[model samples]
Structure formats: C-alpha cells, structure tokens
Target: MTKKRALGFGYLPQESKHHFLLVTPRSPNEDVAVYERFDWDESENQETGIVEDNLRVTLDRHKWNSIKDFLTTSFNNRLKENDVTVGRFKIGHVPIERLLGKEMVLLMWAIEDSDPQLISTAIKNWSGLSREERWWLFTMANAITGHADDKRGWRKAIRFALTENPIDDEDKSQVNMFEMFYKNVK
Candidate 1:
C-alpha cells in the first residue's frame, strides 16, 4: 500500500490562548497606524466581567410600588427645577415619568462620578411616587434617559412595556397602562 501523506497539521503551530488585539486605524492620510494589543490569560471572573454591573435593577412586586412613587416624585422635582413649560398657558406640567428616568440616569452617573449632593437631591425628589408607580416610571425613565430622540425613546418605551419580561405580577399588570393613559388623554 502507498504511504498516506499526513494532512496540513505541520503547516502552522498551534495558536496561543488569551491573545487579543484591539486596533484603531489612523486617518486615511497617515501611512502607519498605532495599535494597542493585550495578551494575557483572563481569570474566570475577568472573562465573566462582573455581570451584575450590566444587570438592570430588579424590582419585585413588593418593592415595585414604593420604587415607582420615588421616581414619580423625582421626575416632578426635576421638571420644576428645569422650568419646562408644557400646557397652553406655558405653565410647567410635570413630566414625572420622563423626569424619573432622567433623574435616575443622572443619579447613576453622578454616583459614578462621586457627586454625593446630586445623588441626595435625586433621592429626596424620588420619594414622592407610590412604589408601583415608581416601578412603572422607571421603565419610562429608562427609555427617555437612554437615547436623545424623545419620540423614538417614547416609542421604544412603549414597545418595551409590551415585550420584555416584567419583574412581577404587578409589573405585568402595568403593561397596557401607558396605552390606556394616552388613550384617555387623547
């Protein structure tokens, strides 16, 4: 029988683990681009990378109402502080739902930036709504505080209410609440 040639195994050495390169290309006019590369075995936790940091706060049924109340108050306070006039008279109408999300995001960023006073203001303002209201408000708040486009954000918020799994039975009940609120207003 003719001796069979070993396949392509000998062509290249085994690739090393934990080797990752992140590269940014220089402008088109530039001939050489600078690149930074990292090569180190990541630990299990590093690989996982603190999943909790990415997790949205979980508001169960018992906590839902209280949280909602707090957000409502915060939102109202922010509206007042900003002096945003809404109605026919140009008097400020509290966009409580909108404010809640903005305040929360601001507060979160403030905490990250080590601004204790802002955090305290947010907390104090947030203490107004009932827990259930606050929970619903948070979902609304996330939409507004997320992207800059208000109309797009509102639509997204409505979609999220219709789709994403809610924290509890109470949350599930609030799914159609936005639609109802808008319908009644119109």
Candidate 2:
C-alpha cells in the first residue's frame, strides 16, 4: 500500500518511510513496479541491484537508515536524495551516485571496528591515522569507487570529509575542515 517514488537507482516506496527501496536496475526511471504482484522482500531488492551487479551499495536496512542520518548530521552532506541525474553532486569530479555506493564499501573496510557511524567515529578513524595510512585508505577506497580523473583519489576522501559551508565564520582558518578534524583527532 505504499506509493513508489523515484530515487535514482531505485524507487523509494514511500518518502515518509525511508528505510528501504525497490530497485529497477534494467529500467531505472520507469514505473516498473518491481514489487507489483509479489510480496516485498529486502533480499529480492538487493539481488536485483547490489549482489548481481556490484554497482550499487548494499547495507542492512537499519544500517542504511543510520548512514543517511549520519551523513546529514556529521558531514552536513547527503547521498543525493534525488537520483534522477547520474551524478547530481560531484565528489572529486566523479558522480556521487556512482562513487558513493562503492566508496561506502571501502569505508566499511577502513573502519572495520566501527560501522562507519559517520560522525566523530569516522572522522577519528581517518584523522587519527597517518597520512600514509590515509593515503592507503584513499587508494583502496578510490579503487572501489571507480578511479577518478587525473588521479584525484585523495580529493574524493577529502571531499567526503567536506562540510556544507566552508565560510561559516569571519576567520578563514575556521573554514578549513581537515585541520579542524586533525585537531579534534589529536
């Protein structure tokens, strides 16, 4: 009894309930009604998109919800709610939709101890590590996130660490986010 709303790679059954979605891989934007006659199942949704293709990001429903909230609260960024355009917002010159799905997988490995809580934990995990370590994380993350142009892998992670507003205060120092996290990490 839920209304399907187009959400890029899939259809979010109801905007009010952002838990899970029914994906239409073959025809992304059409009203495919993938779950029309059948009972809705999360595994089925995953099979149609994530498992088979390895092109989409697949996480437990609960984890996915947490990821959304974490992205909004911690980074003040979103995973591009509207998936109509392939890469609505660019992350290191790569489309967010395409890059994020895989980057998330890499992020998981980076913070294996943490489920990428996406707040202080993720920042701590990244900042606490050495530049060489961060570089390793970046290279690995980029490999999964579909290598960016001009070897901008580092920029992808840095961009992921970006905030909504850089110039929030009078002082320019306050705008640089990596230093802020680096200070907090130490």
Candidate 3:
C-alpha cells in the first residue's frame, strides 16, 4: 500500500518504495507528508501568491517589446492613411484618454519612440505653450496616428479651437460673404 498525505483539496499522490515525492498542502488544515525516506517542509512549498507575482513580473518584462512593436505598426498604418490629414497636420489637439482609450499605449510608445526628448525639444521651441501643451501634443499625435480613436472627443476639441479666438469684425464679414456666395452657388 502506498502512503498518502492529505492535500486539503484532495489526497496527494502516494509514495513509492524507491522514490519519495514532495507534495504541498493546499489548505491550512492539510498537512504535507513524505511518501518515503525524505525530509520536507511547508516553507519549501511554492506559495500560489508568490508564483503569480513572479509570473506577472516575467510577462510584463518579456512582453513589453512585442506590445511596443504591435502598437508601432498599427499607429504607423493609421498615420499613413490619406483621409485623416488636415493640411499636413494629421493629429489635432484632443485628450489622450479619449483618443487612445488606454494610457499604457501612449506610455509604451512614448518610451519606445524617445518621445520625451522630442517633447522637450518642442517645448523649448514653442516655449509659450506650457507642459500641458506638450502633453496634449503628444496625445494628439498618437490619436492622429491611429494609435488611438478620438473621433467624438475631436469634435468637442474642434468646437473649443474655433471658439478660442473670437471672430474679428473683418473675419466675420468674410465668413458672411463666403456664406452668401456658397448659398448662391447652391
């Protein structure tokens, strides 16, 4: 008869005559027992929590490169599309979260593309706009590049852009004239 140990959830595999098996108990009440002439301790048993943590860390480190590549390819494809262009400016000012829907995408791409350095240079050149402007620009670039989807958010942003500078009397007259001309054309 093979010697068996209580595994909490079930019985541990029985020990054989020639070899000893090390088994971990599943619950607090279950006690681990050696099947043959071998020493075992509860501390040596792998804790589920520790194993999960190690797995998460390993996945995060190893998978980051693959994720970056996928995002870069996808973003490049979107940026290359013709319909989304707005006079050489593909991306417009919009919230990052609204466009990308995931902050991690932006963070990963920014890190991989050395966007921080580029951003720093842009900030230096456009010193008038604050950090918010730089961050917004980064987000807008990602959104425009198709790394993120921000159509709804873009509409709202457009409204804000148009309203930012009040229409001057001269511009208003030009707009009215254009409207009348378009109406006549119609």
Candidate 4:
C-alpha cells in the first residue's frame, strides 16, 4: 500500500480516535477517499488502528476538478487558523477534524450512489449549504445511520434530497427537503 498523505483539519497527527479521510492516489488526477470511522473502544487498545469501512467515494478527475479549489481553499484556511505551517504535506493516515470529517462524510454519503454525470449538480447543492447546515445535516444522519455498514434511513434520504432533487425556482427545494426530513426523522 502506498503511504497516504495525512491532511489534518482540527487534530494533531497523534489523535487516533477521530475519523480519517484516507485519500489513496490512483493516478495523477484520480484518487479515492475512503472515509474511515474510528470510535474509541474501552476494550481495544489504540496502538492497533481500527478502520471501519464506512464510505468509499471515488473522486475522479472531473469530480476532483469541480471541488478541488473549494476544498483546498477551505482546508488551507483552517490549517492556518490552527497555527500549523500553511501548505505542508505529509504521508500516511489523513486526520480530519471531527466536525470536518462529518461534513465531508455527509457530502460523500450524498453522492456515493449517485449518477456520475450529475456530480456537478450534487456539488453545487452541497456548496450552497452553509457549514452549519452541513454540520447539522451530518449530525442528524450520523445519529441514526452513521455506522460504516448502515446505508439506509437518513443516508438514503440525503441522496434523494441532493441528487434526485435538482435546483428549483425557489432554490430551497433541497434545503427544504432537508428540513422536512429532519422534522419527519422520528
């Protein structure tokens, strides 16, 4: 296995309990980000890493091109705020902030099973949502259908809201659907 580069958002490299976005490069422009959920367990030792097969979102060149600028810019800004050297790269095990991990996973979950052609649409809708909105949506989804193997419930609902529902005249169709789902999640 190639040594993966670690991108930190809110935690240091030593933090093992937080989630990770393992970006494995396939080619110059192609890579797959495996979102691994690492929950702390009392019985298990932390030295041995535990990577739950949570979500695999393949970001091809096109998809990467669509969101690269936004992601790099946003992440770099966060890194600077964390008092880390800006634009530094490292190898092996990417560590993302807990909330950032949730946001990224939520976006990945939304488009995991979507049509490849409609990625731009999904990304557009995702970008339209504020960080708080994204975090809230992730919180709701993670609370119920957050496990690596659980792929229904809020997960399915998120896919439907972002991918199936396109931009509308009001622009709140997707957002509205998210609110509606939140209300009906019981």
> For residues 1-186, could you state the per-residue lDDT of candidate 3 as single tens digits?
332222221112232112222232444344222122122234554322132211100112223433434434443343334222111101111111122213223333333323233332322232333336435754564355422123335323432332232233432311234665798998
Residue-level error in angstroms, candidate 2, position 42: 21
With a 3 Å backbone cut-off (N, CA, C), the pairs that clash in candidate 3 are: none
Q: Put down candidate 2 lDDT per residue, 1-186, tens digits, no spaces.
A: 332233333323332222222232343233211111112344454344322222223233433333434433322233233323221211111112222333343443333223344434444443344445544554565455522222235444453543222343333322456777799999
Once fitted onto the true fold, the runs of candidate 2 whose alpha carbons sit more than 4 angstroms away are 1-64, 72-96, 111-119, 124-186
Per-candidate TM-scores read 0.22, 0.29, 0.17, 0.63
lDDT of 1 by residue, 40-141 (tens): 233433233323222322222222222334544544444445443211101111111222333343323222222233333334333333555545654564
Would you list the C-alpha lDDT of every candidate in the order shown? Answer: 0.31, 0.34, 0.30, 0.62
The candidate that achieves the highest TM-score relative to the unseen native structure: 4
TM-score of 1: 0.22
Cα distance off (Å), candidate 1, residue 71: 14
Clashes of each: 15, 1, 0, 1
TM-score between model 2 and native? 0.29
- Pick the winner on lDDT between candidates 1 and 4: 4
Error of 1 at 116 (Å): 3.9
The TM-score-based order of candidates, best leading, equals 4, 2, 1, 3
Compute the lDDT of residue 64 as modeled in candidate 2: 37
Q: Please tell me which model should have the higher TM-score, number 3 or number 4.
A: 4
